[model samples]
Target: MMPLVHSLSADDEIFSVSVSHDGTRVAASYNDAIMIWDTHTGCRTLGPLKGHEYWVWSVAFSPDGRSLASGSSDNTIRIWDTETGTELLEPLNQHTDEVTLVLYSYAGTFLISGSDDHTVNIWDPYTGNLIGPPIDTGDRVSSVAISPDSTKIAIASFNNTLRIYDFATVSPILHDFTIHVCDAATGISIGNPFRGHTNVVTSVAFSPDCRYIASGSDDMMIILWDAVTGQICAEPLAGHSSGISAVVFTSEGSLLVSGSRDHSIKVWDVGAVIRRVELANGSNSIVTQRIDLEITSVMSLKDVVSRLTDWGCTDMSAELDWTSVGDYPISQGGFGDIYRCKLTDGHEVAVKTLRVYVDPDEQTRKSLKHAAREIYTWSKLKHPNVQPLLGLVVFREQVGMLATWEPNGNLPSYIERNRETDRCLLGAQIAEGLAYLHDLGVVHGDLKGVNVLVSKDEIAQLADFGNAVLREYTIQFSKTSTKHNISPRWTAPELFRGSKYSMEADVYALGMV
Candidate 1:
């Protein structure tokens, strides 16, 4: 496809380019300077705003298009007034190494930056104050982007991983090179990572509507991702002859502009691309469901609890005292929080409650049903390598599952404590637990080091059945309902290709563990 508007030539190599929210102005950064151009006439409206001591790697426009932010190899970030071509405030110099990328939140409330210093920093654009401590990514940061809602931040780094973190809590949730979607609030990875690029991913951007993600790679291709299902929306967008340096969707999301090392900028008509992909697939519609907004299961909280009781699982809600439960959760996950609590019988247990922040009515229902399904599956297991489900309790007006609290914590923490511990035995115990689950026709869909807990006896036990399902009866439910609960780094390759979780996939995850 031909670019809708390609009208800029630079004597120097362009490191990055950004389009204003109004889609009228374009900002390009190169060799210690920034320039602004009129989109239609290709006229340079603003020139060579030069103050940086070294190469400027990134430039971005605020939502209002009145200000521009640039990051440079000088290890500084500067804000520039778009109209007067003057530097705003002081140089924001928190990074210790070259600043690679800078981006403003969709609301223009704060600015985010990534650097070769291996940190991602959040700053207030107006006051130029650092928001919090810098996030230590442990690898040189390459590119950074904030989601449309401004709740999550996605950082691509030199370590070949793209990680998503909650903007409010600064918790790293999703981690993988293949592009995984995550729940911003609960830090749970949603579905599999979108995988198609054959080379390193260079940049990623989310649409204004938060429905799609566009990623550019060294493979000279741009892939659009369905934000809800973590699926590739269309075929690879191929036009740039050299590696793509940057990509951005216009404020309205109708046009996508890409910059390349080929010294060219190409604007793609996104609507036309979608239309062509749909026609090629012989379908009028591309998206079948919005997983976040829709509920696919018919089971309700009442039905789930009734099924659990019918199956002879203990319901501790009536017998347990809710006052003994901890007032705050010790840890949090996508579906809920984990709290250490004590039973009236003097035994200690970990209580996990559903943590739903949005769409309380529908989400609570779905979460309750999911929790109940987990309880049902967990109650069927009785193995030494698996954590046993003691019972179900109602606390804080939410249903929580109870299990024996392992003092040694998860596998990662356990290994951190005992560096000389035998990992082979831990791996074997994990395999034993997984084999037990598969023998009973259950697929532990999500498995990772974090999901493996170390008991006081120094034994590895499998926990967290939020994604487990009975193979014969729930093939479809496992494929669709809990699809978002997967951890991409530990996920089997076939799951990324749309295969349902099976015993073979479980074995593959065991290998990853």
Candidate 2:
């Protein structure tokens, strides 16, 4: 096959580059200006944008091709009205230091820019207004990209960490990655630094569909990242004999063009290059290095709260309880006491105070079992509707299980109060809970209404897994309670036979409900 066609030049060292969505116009940033040129004509320049005070580091065209944004060492981002050749608004002036890069998200609704100030700022391009809180990176944020679907933001920083943040909150969805690291750090050295050109990262651009991010470096390498996981997916694009100046994804999404200090423009068939690296060596070279965060896979709030409960962690909002509140003192379960304690932070936590002062000989075995059964299980479960185990609270004779509080009470209470209305809904919720547990390869051997909690929304969650067992894994249930809706009327036939419970058994009980 013909190698992807690219051109070369030895003239002005290009600092930054971007292509219009139609693949017709190309813009390059140099010393103090941006040069707009026609790709097909190979013309010297269509126009020169001359407003930056210092070196312009990056430039990007708006999705609709009507506007252009440039970031500069002057500590400002400028939005120019492309059609009118007039400055559209005052420079977006929030960076504490030089603005390093500017990019229009795929939708053109927001402009994201990174700076030498160790921050990434977001702007509403239409009104030239700051949109959300500036993301604090704690180190120079080298590059930023809003994913194609616009749900994620990837920020590569000088700390050698790639932080994946949720677009909605700008909170870290995933953190502490080593995709593009500063050479100063001590870890596994990425052999020869993608051609050994020495410098920090300077630019990052996502593929047209946002599947990959192309990051340019002062080191002269262009590394492509799997946008989904924030991991490196290709070997360093190393044609540039000097520091790579800019990296851009073509509008057609098939090629990535990079400009370098060596004065050459290289076009790459992204598919061939990435596929070779991905399938080479039997596994992706960067799979382990890339941290992929599946935003769309996030569970609902209910699942989040539920997981906290299952893990014995309290919600950040629960009321703090110093003294026990109910008519009954905190009751003890198989592993610990379920104290209804309010956290100092006002969140209700199911403090499972471990039975203190256990016999020494039994401690090791019991601790091992508890670690495997409770802590490990809680840590792995991530779903919105599932209760999350926030953390452990330890006391003299007890370990507290701080999880979310289900205010509406358990399934039995809701069933007794709501009767007909709650029955079908609660039944469905119980089924869902069972399905979730099974999906995670768990079987709540003691599945029943009393072992289930009902949220205010009437959603049912399977609880009290003290007697739960992993399907096909032999761990006997120490003890269990039968109360309210889990009485003989709701008990499955297998329970009477002392048969080990399975998801099918949970379904049998759910059907009873």
Highest-scoring model, lDDT = 1
C-alpha-based local distance difference test score of model 1:
0.74
What C-alpha RMSD separates each model from the true structure? 22.6, 17.3
lDDT by residue (tens digit), candidate 2, 14-47: 8878888866567777777776654433444445
Instruction: List the candidate 1 regions with Cα displacement exceeding 4 Å.
Output: 131-137, 143-177, 183-195, 225-236, 278-513
Once model 1 is optimally superposed onto the true structure by TM-score, how far is the C-alpha of residue 490 displaced, in angstroms?
64
- TM-score of candidate 1 to 2 decimals: 0.48
In candidate 1, which residue pairs get closer than 3 Å at backbone N, Cα or C atoms, i.e. clash?
191-484
